[model samples]
Target: MRFLLIEDHEDLGRSVQERLMLEGHAVDLAQTLAQAREFQQAAVYDLVLLDIMLPDGDGRVFLTSQREAGNTTPVIVMTARAAISDRVGTLDMGADDYITKPFDYAELEARCRAILRRRGGVADTRHRHADLTFDPLAGTIEVNGETRELRSRELRLLEVFLGAPGRILSKDHLCDRLFSFSEPVSDNAIEVYVGRLRKKLAGSRLRIDTMRGLGYRLSGT
Candidate 1:
């Protein structure tokens, strides 16, 4: 899933970003509310990881604005405030979940999965296409009873394809889900990942079709 992470501290933001990337989720990191707003305006996100204290504004107020504006994207507040009032305040303000700083990364990730699962109730994390079985969260795929480790980028690529099977997804859309907003990615980078995924699914009943000038689609043979 794609996420918009609003965090001011550079170190913490980078840490969270890297951790999420390792889990095969695309993330856009914002240091201020202004940047966050820009990202929100430009792209859609499956979730938002927000920090209460930002360089330009308070995330709680931002949270309030989102609710007032009817932006229903799930948000998880990440901050150092451990007060019970802080938790209740954010939750009342529309935060789906709250995590105090110095928390475990694994716990944070678990919270993310839990929140997403609730949002997409019964959203099957496992997908099947022909003889291939893909578990995106597990970062692995099974083909003909053989299991293969899918690197992060390949995992995200396959996940996006499976989300809209048989539908053509533009390169820009794919890029949106595969790379961060600031990552310097060339067109060939996506092609490289696509080629890699093609090889990974080589013997499966599913294949990727390239629609010249349009985009790519996953089709089952």
Candidate 2:
């Protein structure tokens, strides 16, 4: 999943970004409300980890603006505000969940998964395409009863294709989804990852089809 992490604290933000990336999720870190808005406008995110107290302004207000603008992207607010009213206020302003500061990383990860599951209507973390089974959480792919580990990039690539089976995804769109805003990536880099993923899925029922001008699509034979 792609996530937008809006945080100001250097250490916490870096920790969260690294943790999420290690879990095979692409994350873009924004330090202030302005930066967060720019990132949010540039791409669609599966979820957002927002810190209520930002350098530029209150995160709740930014969330409120997002809601008012009809952006239904799920937001999980992280703040030191432990008061019940504070929590309620964030929820009322359209935060999908709230986590107080100094919380466990495990709890945050769990909440992210829960919210994504509910939104995606996917109870299980495993995604399937024909005879191929992909466990996003485990970062493994199984085909014909044989399981193999996937590199982080390969796993993310497969997730993108699996999410929209049989649909053509433009190179630009795929690049945006696979690489974070901060990462330097070229169209050729996307091709390299796609080639690697195709090689990995060799002999499987699922195939990646390249369209002349449209881009690529995942198809099952």
Candidate 3:
């Protein structure tokens, strides 16, 4: 999953980014509210880890703006303040969850996953169809109970398929979703990953159908 970490502290932001990366998540770090706003406008994210105190502006303002814009991206407010009123205010302002400052990195990761899982409407990380099983967190594919790990890019492609099963996804859209603003990924690269995934799931009922000019789909029928 993709995440946006909005923090002003350089050290804390870097640490959180590294930890989330180790957990198999793609994260973008924004050290200021301006940077965060820019990133939010350009890219889509599964979750946003926001620090309530910013050098430029209050994180609460950013949250309010996002909500006003009808952005439903789940946000977890992180703050040094532990006052009851602050917590209540953040929640009332539309935060999906909250974490206090000097927090544990593990707890932050867990909270992010919990929010995403709830929003995904699936309690488990596994998404299954027919005989094919996909674990987004582990980046593993199981066919007939035989499991194999996937490369990062291939796993990302599989994620898109699992999330929108039976629906066609254009290669262009897939490229935009799987890659970040910094990386340059091509159409052939996407095809390569898709080809690799097909071989990995060769024995399963899962099939990625190519619709010529349209793109690809995980065909159920």
Candidate 4:
């Protein structure tokens, strides 16, 4: 899953971003409203972690604007405001969930998974493509009941491909999905990951096809 975390606090933002990445989800951290909006426009995120107190503006206003724009992307607001009214206000502004500051990472992860399940963003922890089964939480892949070990990057790339089988994915978009803003990634790097993934799927019905000057597509034989 791809997540956009809108947070300004350096320590908090970095911690959350790193934690999410370690959990096998691609995360993009935006420190300000402007940066968040730009990232939102560029990518389609499965969920958003929004901080209400931002440097430029209030997070509630931003959530309201996004809702008004018909952006139904699930949003979970994180704020220090623990008052009942504050919670109600955020929910009224279209936030799907609220987490108070100083909360545990475990709690946050649980809420995120629960919300995603409710929104149908992730029907389950396991995903299927042809005969291949992928468990994002366990970071494991199984084929015909046999387990296959894959590198972290390989798993991430395969997850993206399985999400949209038969769809063409551009190099730029794949780069965006695979790496975060802080990581330096090139087209050659993407090709390297794809090459590694291709070798792993050798006996599977799934195939990743390269479209020169276009991109790559994952299809079944």
Candidate 5:
């Protein structure tokens, strides 16, 4: 998932951006309401972490504009205002969730997960490309009525590729998504996994295309 973080405090904003990137999600940070508004109009994000008190304007007004423009992207509002009225007002203005300032980093992560799960309720885990089907929940790959179970790493790599389809994802990005922050993985590990996945898909029409200086993409017939 891609996220937009709208915060005025540079230090806190950087911390949140680093943490979220380590968690494997693509993130973009905006320090002012004006920048955030421009980003919202140009790019689509899975979620937005909005600060109520921005340098240029109120986060509520920006959110209200988004709503009026029919942008239904989920927003989680963060504010220093702990008063009941402030909380209620933001909620009424269309914040999916609210977190007071000085929040736990872990709790914020959990809240983001909950909002995404609620927004994109149960995406299809079964992805299809031509005659091949990848079932993530079952950890199985099928081609021409033949199926085989995959190892855990293989499954994880396949899930990321299948989920994004045509997007080019660098090996570093892939590693971040496939493993947690503390896990130890070699620099060449992604290539090794890609090789294994290619072998698994050898008999099918689907293929992982490697772009020089860029990344790999799963292209299917």
Candidate 6:
């Protein structure tokens, strides 16, 4: 999944970015609201980790703007505020979840996964399509009863496919979801990932179909 992290604190921002990156997700870090807006305009994020206090303004302002503009990207507000009102107020502003500062990485990651699982409308990280079983939390995919680990990008690609099953996904949309803004990408990056995934899905009933000039779709062959 791709993420937009809006934070001003240097150490915390880097720490969180590194942690999320290590987990095989692409993340873009913005230290100010302006940069955050720029990143938002440039890329589509599956999730946004927002900080309450920013250099330009409070995080609530950004969240309010996103909701008013009909941007439904999930947001998780990170705040150091201890007051219950502050926590409740963020939720009222359309935050999907919130984590208090001074939090452990494990707890924060858990919250992120929980939100994503809910966003994908799946009860858990485990999903199966015919004989192909995917458990992202476990970092393993079972194809025709054979289990193996896939690369990070491959796993992420499966996550997107699993979320929408047979829906057509455009290359532009796939590119946005699969890479960070800073990552250098080739014109055929999505195709490369799709090709790799196709090889992995061999012997399974599912296949990725390329629609001419449209996009790609995961469907049973």
**Candidate number achieving the greatest TM-score relative to the actual structure:** 1
| TM-score-superior candidate, 1 or 2 | 1
Error of 1 at 105 (Å): 1.8
Please provide TM-scores, in order, for all candidate models, with all chains considered together: 0.91, 0.91, 0.85, 0.88, 0.64, 0.87
lDDT (10s digit) by residue, model 1, range 1-221: 79999999999999999999878788999999999999988988999999989889899999999999999999999999999998998999999999999889999999999897788674787767788988867888998888998898998798789879989999999999888786789868888999999999978889999999999999993
Instruction: RMSD for all candidates, in order, please.
Output: 1.9, 1.9, 2.5, 2.2, 6.6, 2.3
**Local distance difference test, each candidate:** 0.90, 0.89, 0.84, 0.87, 0.82, 0.89
Looking at model 4, which ten-residue stretch has the lowest summed lDDT?
A: 178-187
Q: Which stretches of candidate 6 lie over 4 Å from their true place?
A: 164-171, 186-188, 210-216
lDDT of 1 at 89: 83
Residues 1-221, model 6: lDDT tens digits? 99999999999999999899888799999999999999988887889999988989989998999999999999999999978999898999899998999899999899999998898788877787788888988888898779988888899998888767789999988887888876789999999999999999888998999999999998982
Q: Name the 10 consecutive residues with the lowest summed lDDT in model 1.
A: 120-129
Candidate with better lDDT, 4 vs 6: 6
What is candidate 6's CA lDDT for residue 69? 95
The local lDDT score (0 to 100) that residue 60 gets in candidate 3 is: 97
Residues 108-158, candidate 3: write the lDDT tens digits.
988987887799888788987788888877778888879999887678777
Q: Report the lDDT tens digits of candidate 2 across residue range 16-106.
A: 9989888767899999999987887799898999998887898888999999999999999999989999999889999999999999999
lDDT string, candidate 5, 93-211, tens digits: 88999999999999999898778656646466566778898775567899888897877678767867876888999987787656533347798888998998898898898899999
Model 5 residue 120 lDDT?
Answer: 48
Q: Give the TM-score of candidate 6.
A: 0.87
* Clashes (N, CA, C under 3 Å) per candidate: 0, 0, 0, 0, 0, 0
Candidates 1 and 4: which is better by TM-score? 1
Cα lDDT, model 6, residue 172: 88
